[model samples]
Target: MIPITTVKYPVNEFFQTIQGEGLYTGTPALFLRLQGCPVGCPWCDTKHTWEKSDNARVSAEAMLAKTAPSEAWAEMSAVEILNVIEAQGFTAKHIVITGGEPAMYDLMPLGQELEQHGYQLQIETSGTFPLHVTENTWVTVSPKLDMPGGYLVRPDCMQRADEVKYPVAMEKHIDALDLLLKNCPPRQDTIIALQPISQRPRATELAMQVCIERNWRLSVQMHKYLNIE
Candidate 1:
């Protein structure tokens, strides 16, 4: 087994951007996107991150230099990643750990290291894999149901989420979420938000209607609208 100190995360991309969704919308954040996910969501925008190609591994510098999205990834230990962040002089103290299903690997090491330096952590995950993040990490479990990967959302993950940001495109999607909510209730104060699939008009209208009726929040993929990274 790899030693804890040497534990490296296969990173797809890292950058500072405005958080475009969930309870922390509009927050200035540093996004550290990890590579690899088997929980296939058909509408996933970062399909380049779905596979960690062995031949695509490159130096951290080369990975960061990437201007276009591709399968290229770099393995960086907690310390190395921290150094890069510091070197870039990033102003965002709130770091978002996302994927390609980031929870597929243990995040505690990265979390602990980041937190030690006074950065708050948040993870966006499909509540399928077992979560192994810092206790203080804000968990956002966007339940993925009936995906091609054949993974089931974990009750523990739903219960632990600080926010449940479910993606919706139809009445059936809402129905599925209702069932999940009933079966795996989140914390009493857990924020529930609906994100329209790819800003489709029907999906957005459905999401807005449901959010209005249920007092849920709406996540409009602000980055997409703003045409920002």
Candidate 2:
């Protein structure tokens, strides 16, 4: 077993940016991207965060130093993080908790801390681990398929998801989505989105067609296509 003591988060980068997916899409938010993922998605754009040890580990203060003050960041305790958000003069109330698979960490403290301060917490996860989070937090579980360092996305993860944002490149990915959905209890409010893999137009066409036929939603990586970080 990898010793928990040796497991320090790489934290490749963090910044304030408009959230680019799911229900909170287009909302200006603070992003805390903890680095390290075991569930490998073949097309993961942020694969740079895959290793916990290789990337430089720095204090949250050092991480914040790389960005602009107006960009809204500071090395923060749960309480201190809230203060920084208030100080930033941001009117947006969303807080996005993303990562190289944030489910790898016990995020209860961080989630509870954010909620106490009135911030709506949204977690973008690969659903490889059983999630431990506050009841009110919104979960976007983007399920992973067979890849190196193979991990099974637990059934509980899908059942708990507020949204299932599946990435698609071809029929195999759609098959994976169908398999996952087979286990999830059908509900009207359960959001099903097909995000084109890597903004490919052919893939987008497939996703759009499926969305139109099933009354599901399409999740375009608008941030990438729009050339925003």
Candidate 3:
């Protein structure tokens, strides 16, 4: 494993694309997907990123060559990541640091560097680990419940989040979110969004009803709808 102090991260992939979900949906952004996660959601789309191994230690070029899901990753220092962004000529000012659980590693250094360079940073996490990003970073916590991984959402993680984007697949999912909201009253600025799982019709219907009843917002996966990554 790469040392956290070295400012090196195990990267699964990086690409410039539209923000797929949550509060920043439809916005042009650069996605930095880090590798490794143990909090397994049964419907997880990126199962390939669940483990880290020697196969993940590849060159940056080889990492970018991947056009499909693979258990491959590359270690990249913050400076090297910035170079790649510049080389790619990404014009988006927003940088989304997502992962197999981004909170599993410290993100303060990278967040600080991105802020210094005038880039806004956002982190998408599962809210199972303590957050360590800059205050300016937008933290989106999509809490996983009753998943294969037995990890519970940490209250501290919820309190630190700018938004709680919950995936709704059934009534039980909404009930879990309700219990979570009651347990952790979010900050005044915290946005609560309900995203339908896999864009299922039943899930979408449930989300819409709940959002209306609770006066929360709906976050459809626009990227998935548009057939984009």
Candidate 4:
């Protein structure tokens, strides 16, 4: 693990966009996508981000040229990141610290700075790493079960999440979610969301039924539907 304070994180990309999933869906947000992930889910859209070495480092200006996917990234410190965000003139008050597993790095410094500057912080993680962020940070744990990486979702991560979002592509996926939920701490306010995998008809149907049966929320990837990043 890298030292949080001194590390210049390998940033895959960063941009202002609409919150396309989970509880913050539809909200304006600045996405700070970090690099490197070992939790290799087969259905992962950002496959280019799987390996840190796959991307050559670029300037923050070059990295933000477009919101589209790219095999390019940059290294930036916490303060440098804030500078880039400021330079971009993003008005979105929400900051989504996402990944290639953003939890792959200690995020307390960056998250704390963003919160201190009045930005609402949210972390989108695979629930495979021990989460280390401020208490106010909204942790969204989208547990990846039996993925190619063979990493088990950490029970402490699920317990820490404000929302547990499950991507359902089949009945077994739902079953996995049920088993994962058993490990979560009994919190009345903990939100459970069932997101259909890639908006597939069968998956959507299954997710809708499960959400209704369990009284969970449905999280369809709105960015994919709206043709946005």
Candidate 3 per-residue lDDT, tens place, 59-131, comes to: 9888877899788899887878888988888899999998888889989888887788899999999999999
Q: Distance (Å) between predicted and true CA of 224, model 4?
A: 1.1
lDDT of 2 by residue, 1-229 (tens): 4432333333445567888887677888778776778777777777766766633555666766765322222233565565556666666667777778888877677777678767888889988887878899889988886878788777788888899898898988898789877865434577999999888889999999999999989999878877777
Model 1: residues >4 Å from true position, as ranges? 1-4
Model 2, position 134: C-alpha lDDT score: 89
Superposed model 2: Cα runs more than 4 Å off: 1-11, 67-76, 86-90, 184-188
Native-structure RMSD, model 1: 1.3
Q: Worst lDDT window (10 residues) for model 4? A: 1-10
Model 4 clashing residue pairs (backbone): none
Q: List the residue pairs that clash in candidate 2.
A: none
lDDT, candidate 1, residue 162? Answer: 97
Candidate number with greatest TM-score: 1
Which whole-number lDDT from 0 to 100 does residue 133 have in model 3?
95
Candidate 4 lDDT by residue in tens digits, 137-167? 9999998988889999887888788998888
Greater TM-score among 1 and 4 belongs to 1
Candidate 4, position 221, lDDT: 92
TM-score of each: 0.97, 0.85, 0.96, 0.93
Say which prediction, candidate 1 or candidate 2, comes out ahead on TM-score: 1
> Model 1's lDDT to the true fold?
0.93
In angstroms, how far off is 173's CA in candidate 4?
1.0
Select the stronger candidate by TM-score from 2 and 4. Answer: 4
